[model samples]
Target: MKVERQKDEIVVRFSAGKNASKIQSILDYLRYEELTSKSKATQKDLDLLLKETKRGRFDKIIIEMGLDEKDYR
Candidate 1:
């Protein structure tokens, strides 16, 4: 594993091999941290959002907003 800072971005490099899922989990966590750091939401708000996501509320929200997979494709 290797980490470096380039300008305003932090870069991480690693060999996935048999640990691809673990690496992806770490990356997902880091991405969440980065997003929350720049947002006004509190930890409680984030926790609630995560809980709702786990319950698939976001899928319903997408439908409410008239978004569909076909829109992306």
Candidate 2:
């Protein structure tokens, strides 16, 4: 795996036969970091949000939006 930074973006390249899922996970994290770097939210805020999400805190909002967990399941 290799990483390079361009003027406004980062590029990642991997040789063939690497684990696809792991590469995808890394790419996802890098994309998230890039997107959040321009936002005002701090790591603490993100941690709290992730904690709440894991605790089903947004279930009510999902229901209100007419989205059911069963649909996803």
Candidate 3:
């Protein structure tokens, strides 16, 4: 994954894997969540939800940070 500013819009690109669809859906939910803020969800809530985030979620974030997922190996 990588985040770059293309013209005026931000582009998020990822090197997808076999479970990319599940990862995409989780990401979509998170993006939608940030867009629709009704109540503040605390850190604890996020931590719990992280366990349920599909495979490739961690990989995407790691790549976005310019780090290899193997760092967690």
Q: What is each predicted model's overall lDDT from 0 to 1?
A: 0.81, 0.81, 0.80
Q: Which stretches of candidate 1 lie over 4 Å from their true place?
A: 42-73
Model 3 reaches what TM-score against the true structure? 0.34
Model 2 TM-score relative to the real fold: 0.45
Put down candidate 3 lDDT per residue, 1-73, tens digits, no spaces.
7999989877877886887998789889988987868868798988878775844687778878998777674
**Where does the lowest 10-residue lDDT sum fall in candidate 3?**
51-60
TM-score of each: 0.51, 0.45, 0.34
- Evaluated against the true structure, the overall lDDT of model 3 is 0.80
Looking at model 1, which ten-residue stretch has the lowest summed lDDT? Answer: 54-63
Which residue segments of model 2 deviate by more than 4 Å?
Answer: 2-9, 42-73
